[model samples]
Target: MSDRQKGLIDALQLVVPQVELRFCARHMHVNFKQKWSGKSFKDVMWKACRAYIKFVFDEAMKEIKDMDESAFNYLMAVDPSHWSRHAFREATKLDCLLNNMCESFNKIILQAKDIPILTTKYIRRLLMKRFLVKQESISQFEGRLVP
Candidate 1:
């Protein structure tokens, strides 16, 4: 995933052609908001990006078009598959729209990330700590799945 860089897209196509590229919706919204900012635009843009059904996505885009063709055109310039859920490959089973989780992981591993060996140890320790904490919660749960 990226912030919608054309160069990165080109590079990925060359290096990993089979990998699906995605845009951080947060970044797309920031760029879109620079030209057009308002409640309607924000709501519609989010609706379009979050829509898993193409029809719902199209309806949102149509609304944007009706409000302002230029705004619609601006969004259309970038392929929907890069930033919208409707175009995402179902096989991936991951519908992440932003890099928040990635950022959080990076933050947690920041200190040892430079050393590949240490990074694994750090992550293992972190996971063990987490599992230990979760044990108490799991014991309290009555269902097969935690509540």
Candidate 2:
């Protein structure tokens, strides 16, 4: 998943043609709010994102259209497959709506990003700490599944 930069999309398509590109719904909403900002729009936008079936998606989109045709047109200009759940492929078995995993990794090693030594040390410490905590947590588990 990505924030849907055209250059990055082109590069990914060129490099890994088989990759299923998905735009981060959260980021899309941020861009969407620049023009259509309100509770109703926000609610319907989320409804569209959470829709796992075509009928539900269509209904949510219809609501958006009824409220404001221009907003619906703007959203429709981009293919639904890129950002909407109803059109997504299930090959990955992962239905991620945001780029939260990548963002969290970036956040963990944040600040002084240009400084290699500091960044490396921060990441190393954070990873080690996480692993240790996970290990300890697993050790206390009496269940069959470690996850």
- List ranges where model 1 is wrong by over 4 Å: 109-143
Q: Between which residue pairs do clashes occur in model 1?
A: none
**Best-performing candidate as measured by TM-score:** 2
- With candidate 1 superimposed using the best TM-score fit, by how many Å does residue 99's alpha carbon deviate from the native? 1.5
lDDT of 2 at 108: 69
Compute the lDDT for candidate 2. Answer: 0.90
lDDT of 2 by residue, 29-103 (tens): 999999999999999988988899999999999999999999999899988888888888878788888999988
Q: Lowest summed lDDT over 10 consecutive residues: which window, candidate 1? A: 138-147
TM-scores, each model vs. reference: 0.75, 0.80
Which residue pairs in candidate 2 have backbone atoms (N, alpha carbon, C) closer than 3 angstroms, thus clashing?
none
lDDT of 2 at 28: 94
Q: After superposition, how far is residue 137 of candidate 2 from its true place, in Å?
A: 4.1
